[model samples]
Target chain A: MILARGLRKSFGDFEAVKGIDVDVRRGESFGFLGPNGAGKSSTMRMVAAVSPISGGELHILGMDPADDGPSIRARIGVCPQEDTLDTELTVRDNLYVYGRYFGLPRKEVRARVDELLEFVQLTEKADAMVEDLSGGMKRRLTIARSLINRPDVLLLDEPTTGLDPQARHVVWDRLFRLKQQGVTIVLTTHYMDEAEQLCDRLVVMDKGLIVAEGSPLTLIREHSTREVAELRFGVAPDGDSHEALAEKIADLGHRVEVLPDRLLVYSDDGEEVIARVHERGLEPVAVLVRRSTLEDVFLRLTGRTLVD
Target chain B: MALDQRADDQRAGSTAPTSTIAGAARLFDYWAIAYRRTWKGSAISSFVTPLLYVLAMGVLLGGFIKGDPTRLEGATSYLAFVAPGMVAAQAMTTVFGEVTYPVMGMIKWHKAYFGMTATPLSVPAVVLAHLGFVLFRVGTTCAVFLLVMAPFGVFASVTGVVAAFFVQLLIGLAFATPIYAFSAGLKDESAFSLVFRLGMMPLFLFSGAFFPITNLDPWMAALARATPLWHGVDLTRMLTLDRLDWSMVAVHVAYLAVLALAGWFWAVRRLSRRMIS
Candidate 1:
């Protein structure tokens, strides 16, 4: 549904999105996984046809945005980072009015309004003012409003960023259902769990460039070990002070990374690594065993913290 | 407004419910919806306030001026001369209120324009729609002012009052679209407050609306002649007095139209620059 090559966005002298390439397949969930200043939002804005590209060759649904912005915008749904819901209108009217922007027939807009409100579980709040809704409800309404055009591609910029855990899960469930129904989903999120759950393929961005791109499982397999063992030491809170411990345990596992409070030992067998640690008579304060995740892969790839 | 009827036809299950959009009419629906929610609070600015100016200047002061012959400005009565002045001034005031803070707020505060442009609507379409709604507001305010002016028997003919409506709309756009151009590039409301106090208030008082520009020095009169509101006031006053000057009418209409056209160009350029990034 979307394709870009050598995409670049610059504001005056500062380039927000350095030259990069991306392709989002139809009916699949694609994600841009990066921290705050990783050019994710810039990339998403360019894809949504709201911002013009400073330099790039881009196409959405096979049409260039520079030549066909309005026509291209007609077939895509965009949920910006901030909720742009009309605060004065009713929750349902927000959907109805936005659909009218697409030049949709009023009857079709009304029909879609009903289905969307029910889909987002906003039926009871149909007549209520948008200003009175809670944060989670507002996010859901934004999502529902985007879907009003029956768009071919849905672009979400951190759809679940400020929501609570339960609210985030509800949004994830709704998004998963949309994917099952064959809507191409493209989103940007800093949450590793969000990327792991929703994105079939994603790019890890750092600065203005992409460092890696792959499926979540494939990324973990390629960039991280199968299992990880965490170790803490009696030293300064700064993880660099535990370099002595890193040296002692460096040969026990395939790789070792020292963080502020914990040391990560990467190996195929976490139990065997822990036994080897005990055999070395290095009794750490605490230890934990877990499978390698996108978090580990992201940390390994970018060397930047996920959340600022 | 016929969009409502078409929507009704669509709901009635007409043969095919196609959405046919006219020039900037669809974008006007956004402001119309906003007006439906906030119109009650707007009465102070649109209806009640403009009428008070009519009463204060035309009715209250007309008593003192009726005994004096010089202040009549060749008209039969003071009420006759000042009532249309109030109408033209109200059009400028109403349109200034519509354009300045609201245009800046939609971009910097509420972000409504961004929401509009996120869809198929272009930046120029947004500018035209906003100015279109501002014209609608000018019509509403002038219509109410005309009714108030009628009891004083100020209309020389029914067409004179009808001309007031069209003239007010033209004057409103002439004043609004330029300020809208300035507002599009503003990052803060500091300039918005100044435009009202320093920019619009002086023009409202000195643009030959309250009194004849001939009373001022030649230089101030020339300055007033350059303003869109002065032409508006001059035009409305001539129509209300049943005295039509063909040459001045042509000049005044051309002045307001040119300003409106130039301001529209600036508004489109500045707004698209601000929005399309």
Candidate 2:
């Protein structure tokens, strides 16, 4: 449904999105995962057909964005990173007027407004002012407004960035239902767990470049080990001295990453690595054996965590 | 539905309006819907405020000025001379009220323009929709003021009243469109104070709305003549008095029309730069 070859976006002298290629198939959930300044939003803006591409070839539904922006926009739904809900109108009116902007008939828009309010579970707040809504409710209203036209593709930027845990789950449930309904979803997020939960395939971006692309499990397998053992010793509570401890347990696992508070030992067998550590007579303060996740893969690829 | 089924359904639904005017009118529905909720807030300013102006300035103050009709510039009474100018000046204030802070809020605070453009609406369509709302506001406020003043016998003929009504709309657009462009380009509304104080206030007082411009100094009269509001005031005054001069009417109409056209293009260009890029 969307294709980009060497897509570029530059603001004055600073390039937010350097040349990058992307392909998003119809009815698939795709994602861009990165830190705050990793150009994920810039890439989404180009695909939204709102921002002009500096250089590249982009085709959305077999039409060039430059030549057919309005046409392309008509088929796609966009949830911007910031909530741009109309504060001047009631919650139902926000959805009602947005549908009219797409030239929907008044009766059709009215029907869709009620259906979408129900879909997003905001029917009770239909007449409430937008400013009265909580952050998560506002976000849901924005999502509902975006879907008012029954768009073929939905673009959500940082869909659940500021929501609390329960609210995030609610948003995720609605998005999952949309996916089950066969809507193509494109989203960007800094949370690895969000990417793992929602994206069927994803690309990790850093400093305007894509560093890796794969499904969550495949990425974890290729860039990280099957399991990990975290150990913290009382002798060196928090310092660079973890490097010495890492050297002591060097042969215990495939690799050891030294952190200020602890040491992470990557290996296929976390219990075996923990047993070897005990045999060495190192009375560590804590030890944990856990399966590796996409967080580990991102750390291995970018040398930095996803959120910070 | 799957992607292909959805695309086919959209094709069958007549997804977007075929013409630019249709798109803009559809977008205009937003303002109309919003106004339905808040029209009461503006009722005092639209109806009561103009009544008070006529009572205080045209009726009470005219008692003193009624002693001399010679300085009234062909007007039979002070009420007759000042009522049309009040209508014209009211258009100026109404247009500024619609365009300044609200336009800033749309661009910076609420981002309503961004919301509209995210749909099938283009930037030009958004601009047209907003200015169309401004014109509506100007029409309603001026129409109320005209209706209120009709009992006072200020209008010379019904045709003049009708002509003045259209001129009021044109005057509002002439001031509103360019200011709409200016407000869209701003980051904050701090500069709007200067627009009201330095730009609008002077034109309101010196544009022959109260006294004749011929009573002012020659340089001041020339400066007043140069303002868009002055042309509006003069045209409205002539129309209400049934004093028709074909040549001056052409010049005033042409002047306001050129400004409105130029402002329309400027608003479209500036808004596109801000929203599309």
Which model scores highest in lDDT? Answer: 2
Overall lDDT per candidate, in order of appearance: 0.84, 0.89
Top-DockQ structure, candidate number: 2
TM-score of each: 0.93, 0.96
Of candidate 2 chain A, the 10-residue stretch with the lowest lDDT total is: A233-242
Error of 2 at A31 (Å): 0.5
Model 2 misplacement above 4 A? A232-240, A259-261, A281-284, B1-3, B67-70
Off by over 4 Å in 1: A234-240, A278-283, B1-23, B43-45, B66-71
Which residue pairs in candidate 1 have backbone atoms (N, alpha carbon, C) closer than 3 angstroms, thus clashing?
none
What DockQ do you compute for every candidate structure?
0.35, 0.66
Model 2 chain B poorest ten-residue lDDT run: B10-19
**What lDDT score is found at residue A49 in candidate 2?**
90
TM-score of 1: 0.93
Residue by residue across A1-308, what tens digits does model 1's lDDT show? 78899999999999999988999987789999999989999999999898999997899988988887877787788999998787878998788878777777688889999999999999999999998998899999999988887777899999999999999999999999998986789999999999999999999988889989999999999999999999877664653367778988999888888787778999999988889998988878888999998888878986656886
